[model samples]
Target: MPLLRLIMLALAYLLPLCVWADSIVMVAPRETALTRNFVEALSSRLPTDTFEVRLLSSTPAPDSASLLITLGQEALHWRLRQPIVTPTIATYVTLDGLQQLHDEVRPASVQILLASAKPERQIILAQLLIPRLDTIGLMFSEQQRWQTRFWQAAAIQRGVNLYSRGIPGQDQLPRVLTNVLNQSEVLIGLDDPALYNAENLKTLLLTSYARNRVLIGPSAPFIAAGSLSTTYSSPENMADSVIDMLQETWRPAAIRYPDRFSVLSNQQVARSLGLPPPDDAELMRRIHAQEQSR
Candidate 1:
């Protein structure tokens, strides 16, 4: 009937307008596959037409626009008045060159040590990595005024023995690590970039193993390769956190460690560097289900 046809035509045009009712403003690190995927997944999950994703080298302070989703590794920060936050999307702010997680875990009386070529981001990590650690060590390239005070304050609060050995260079770290091992239970944190770029990964890992130290790094691949363990935040969970934060507009100035992924012991890596992992019945079942569900 002509009357029925007219009604259908009007509904078609109205449907699209109704679909998009909200919007979120996203600011993340420059350009990368992960960033692209984050935009796609987040946009799809949002209740908006255009979830306007803006790419910037750094995430600036929040504006009066829509919700602010920042990804500043560790080099950037913002001044924000705390507001109610309903974290539905896993939005991450990569400030100071470090990406964070939706959750955090604080270990017991753990010793946290750091070695980085740079100061800003490295110092921030050291502080975040501090409360969880019982002892904190500083081996950085620049010991500017702020660096000294930061380390000093952390030491007083935690009563951690703050040891500062000059930044160690390549082929020279194994010996330095050997010396430090005599005092601490764990050697968690990155070796100075001056040393990392100066030496090969194989050498660094081998040295870490030789010292029987539990090495922890921010880079995921390094953890899989040989580090004792690492705190990780997957893109999936990050997406969830971002949604939650955006739904209620709040950027709580805090850091969170990602989920914990088990590491391959030195013994395990030695067993089969080329073969698939040893079959764990429970693990395999979970893996199979996850795959089949997909």
Candidate 2:
């Protein structure tokens, strides 16, 4: 079995190299740290001759490139407008963003790497920390109603209850937050600026802290601010996932999140809330194991 598995893995990697071993072009709306970091890390992992960076505003993608990687919404939008025959992989985009892009380009050959954590991944993170997790709370903008439905089903599968509230607007946040906070043991943060922007994040974090409710953030900044932990992937991880998909001989799934992830924790926040936080390495190990089991 071990020998067979090794052969299969070898074939998977080699097949694509044989068929489509050509330069990759990565496009983004603008130059940013994330884009720079992804290109650097991906270059190290892939062949030195295999990748080049192109900005949506400045340079056109080279015709010689076999694969196209787009970062962020602007780049994805730009790609959809063009007639692209090459295989495209989009990263650093939300689930909603992917859906929106697909609406514009159906029968889309472009694959996606969503920024949001999968429901199972988020639930596992919560369950690992709070073993007795019963009622989970979430706040979402009207645009994210689909997420609430997803979590509701996921929670039931895991023997957990989900309490969710939709934010009609930013003005009603305090009232809606108080209502959900009262019913939930942990509050999940979605990656929506309308609901969790810079202007309201401090209020949300402080309120969660005062309520003694565990706040699960969607990104590193949230974990840094006051969230006990956040489930996200870094740019390098995004690059790695994209590279893996491109190394496939055939077109893969149209939409998916990066297989790699990071679980970041703030020990001070955890300690203040009277919770013990797992070390970063240990937490990542557990998360990857959970994903593999699924």
Candidate 3:
């Protein structure tokens, strides 16, 4: 029985190695530094003993993968075109972008992690930055018109009036923006690239500045481009959020926004508009308290 005991001990040691771990495939459009960094961050958070993470660029996810994650809109669009059998999570997509894709065709077994901050959070930031703020202006492209209701609801909840204008085409921006600016005290930029891309962002900033109105709520990059303020999540924040979601038991398709975010403000822009910008740390604390209270 000494031989049997040796075999038993060997089996005991090997059995643990034989145990199956869940495999997750993360697909990005291309292997850029940004995508690579995100994958590395996410992988570091997962328990190495229980999870195996793989990053893919243009390769099909193995059928054996327990879960599939699409890193950005391009990767998500590519995945949706295929027959998705694996449970999928899509990140780095704006809520409106996801909605647009969903409208085209309902994706199966997919959960969404919206890249944009919640509308309420943006509205709260705007209110806090602009003293006695009464009315906020918003401009949207034809594709982004649906977002107006969300912004309106958030504005109403914060007891501020919303003045929204729709631009059917870029040609209509000058006219539409003038009307929106004329009626509202401050303009809020949405995450829609069609309405707020580099080509037109300068115009928007210059026009708003000339009118002595502040622009808020665009992505973090726009803060340097003269947007007064915005709330944004970092790569680490996104990775932490994804790790938390993975730890939970599987559920039906659900949508989640980043629980952790950072507030960005341009003091120069605020000063230009004659509004005092609150300290970012203090502003973040107030925002957290407001969110918790609700």
Regions more than 4 Å wrong, model 1: 1-21, 28-30, 48-50, 56-64, 73-172, 195-200, 247-267, 270-294
lDDT of 3 by residue, 211-283 (tens): 8888885788998877888888878878887776665644446777877778988898777777776598888
Residue pairs of candidate 3 with colliding backbone atoms: none
Each prediction's Cα lDDT score?
0.41, 0.77, 0.77
lDDT ranking, high to low:
2, 3, 1
State the local distance difference test value for candidate 2: 0.77
Which residue runs of candidate 3 sit more than 4 Å off their true CA positions?
A: 1-21, 49-58, 103-108, 249-251
Candidate number with the higher TM-score (1 or 3): 3
Where does candidate 2 stray beyond 4 Å?
1-19, 249-253
Candidate 1 lDDT score relative to the true structure: 0.41
What does candidate 2's lDDT look like per residue over 1-294, in tens digits? 366544543453346632564677889888878778888887787777877888877878875566788889988888777764556777888866654654685334577788887776787788888888889888899987776777888788778888898989888999999999999889888767678778998889889889998888867888877788877888777767876776565444467878888888989988988888668777778878967886
Better of 1 and 2 by TM-score: 2
Q: How well is each residue in 1-294 modelled by candidate 1, as lDDT tens digits?
A: 366544543342334322322444665657678778766776777756646766554544233332345454321222122231211122343222221222333121111111121222223233332235454444443322224554556456434565544443444655666665555534444433444332456765676566554444534456567753333345554565444433332223434332211211233643433323333343324333433463
Q: Which structure is stronger by lDDT: 1 or 2?
A: 2
Q: What lDDT, from 0 to 1, does candidate 3 have?
A: 0.77
